[model samples]
Target: MAQQKVKRLPDADVEAIFGAFAAAEPEPKGELDYVNPFTLLVAVVLSAQATDAGVNKATKLLFQLADTPKKMVALGPAEIEDKIKTIGLFRNKAKNVFALSQQLIERFDSKVPESREALETLPGVGRKTANVVLNIAFKQPTIAVDTHLFRVANRTGLAPGDNPLKVEQGLLKIVPDQYLLHAHHWLILHGRYICKARKPDCWRCIISEWCRFEPKTPAPKGS
Candidate 1:
């Protein structure tokens, strides 16, 4: 089978696309709701390959029972699994959630680590999860590319690349410093709502003019 050619977007156009996206959704935020950094980390772990709504639904009750790392660890893996069984990979995720909470309580003095290296050392945490926690929890400037972002970057020609890492690097280089703080949330919201995977709402897209995607998807008829 022949490999598909990857698209390349102009830097200026990429900037404009993000600019318009930023203008439209000035203050975007993650869908996951948490009371603290520890809960945010746990929520992100449970969210892998799962919808935020689903995670929130599970966590809404779970967090109330075990919001802190110590409390979560005390809740145990089996208990965690029961609470988050609705999510995909709940068995493994439950194990990691319990183990990670124990690690936090024992290693980090019951606090979510601020550094990326420290954060990723936890059982369930990956680069993307660490980035989300670092940015949202610690207020650090980090972009964690998920499936939605990877697709949006390539589809919109915003930061076209073969993989999430390349797109992440591209965003890091081009994203305006002023917007860096909230860039992740903005891109995620755009990818989630506007520049979708199967079909993009090109007509209603505020950044359509800046997009480099050839033959953009047309607006739905009679809408």
Candidate 2:
């Protein structure tokens, strides 16, 4: 079967779509729960391959016990593993959580570094994780292209790309400066609730008129 080529939204449409998003959600936020930059970093690290609700459920108690690098090191990998056992790949994530905590103490003076390079140096911290921390914790204009973001970006013609990095770059280039800071959260929430993968809720989407996806899913029969 041939792959369908994705259409890219023009700058004006992209701007308008984001403007609508901004208007709808003036102060978007990441769903993951965290008390501070350190906890936020840990939460993002644990969020890989896991849902925000799942991560939050595990981290709620974990963060209360050890929200800082020093406290996390004291809790150790074993306790961390026990707490996050419900999450997928719990063992590996626990190891990373402990290792990253130790690294923070040794290298970063128990502080979460603001730079992407520094954040990526920690265990299990990748581009997506770093982008999340930078944007949510540090208030930087970095977009973390998760599955939801990727799907929405491609489906809406907002920033079609083969991979997350490509999509992130495309969004950085196209999204208006004012919307860049909260664009990640807005798109993530939109994809999760409205622009779903199996059946997008196009009927209710505010940006549906501008979206390039054809054959938009209609409202279910019998209003």
The top-ranked prediction according to TM-score is 2
The C-alpha TM-scores of every prediction are 0.94, 0.97
lDDT of 2 by residue, 4-93 (tens): 357888899998999999889899978999999999998888888999899999999999999899999999889999999999999999
- What lDDT score goes with residue 138 in model 1? 91
Write model 1 residue lDDT over 58-92, tens digit each, in one string.
99989999999889988998999999999999999
Q: What is the C-alpha RMSD of each candidate to the true structure, in Å?
A: 2.1, 1.5
Q: Which ten contiguous residues of candidate 1 have the minimum total lDDT?
A: 1-10
For each candidate, the alpha-carbon lDDT, in order, equals 0.85, 0.92
- List, in order, the clash count of every candidate structure: 0, 0
Report clash pairs, candidate 2. Answer: none
Count of clashing pairs, candidate 2: 0
Positional deviation of 106 in candidate 1, in angstroms? 1.0
